[model samples]
Target: MTAIVARPVSVKLDQETRGRIDRLATSRRRTTHWLMREAIQQYIEREEKLEAYRQNGIAAWEAYQASGLHVTQEEADAWLAKLEAGEDVEPPACHV
Candidate 1:
């Protein structure tokens, strides 16, 4: 295991927003800093997943444009349904 080095960061907020965060933090018995850090962590994770999905879509599009090979919607649905029923099965083969 490795130790993590913590660094200080500064963020500016409006008076009303600061007050709102302070009230929530007091009620939850947590520091405003903790809430802000958690919110940032979650936002980053979600955005990373979205970016990966976008890249995968771009790759799949390029592959289809090059090879003109794919499975039909019905074939894909059937293969997915088999898996949903807890059966171990391979995916449908791609075709031109």
Candidate 2:
């Protein structure tokens, strides 16, 4: 059998809120501390997902800048014209 160690913590809440938590814990056959811990864990997981998205955006922008090339209006028009004419246009200088 595995044994789990528990720690003591203190928090303050309004009487109504405390009553609600107590009711919920009783109905769910769980302790208020357990419910609070589960809620906090879920919140942390959500924050991690948001942070990953933010980091991916920053990395994509850096990659675009590092590619070190830009297409002007005329260049864009020429590329489009070539594509419309069914001509094979080589990739831009920045691309492999």
**All candidates' lDDT scores?**
0.96, 0.84
Report the poorest 10 consecutive residues by lDDT, candidate 1: 31-40
Q: Kindly list the per-residue Cα lDDT of model 2 for residues 1-96, writing each as its tens digit.
A: 899987877888899998998899999999998888887789999999999999999987788788755666677788888989999997444432
Model 1 quality (TM-score) = 0.80
Clashes (N, CA, C under 3 Å) per candidate: 0, 0
TM-score each candidate.
Answer: 0.80, 0.54
**Evaluated with TM-score, which candidate comes out highest?**
1
lDDT value, candidate 1, whole model: 0.96
Off by over 4 Å in 2: 1-9, 68-96
lDDT of 1 by residue, 20-93 (tens): 99999899999999988988999999999999999999999999999999999999999999999999999999
Q: Which stretches of candidate 1 lie over 4 Å from their true place?
A: 1-8
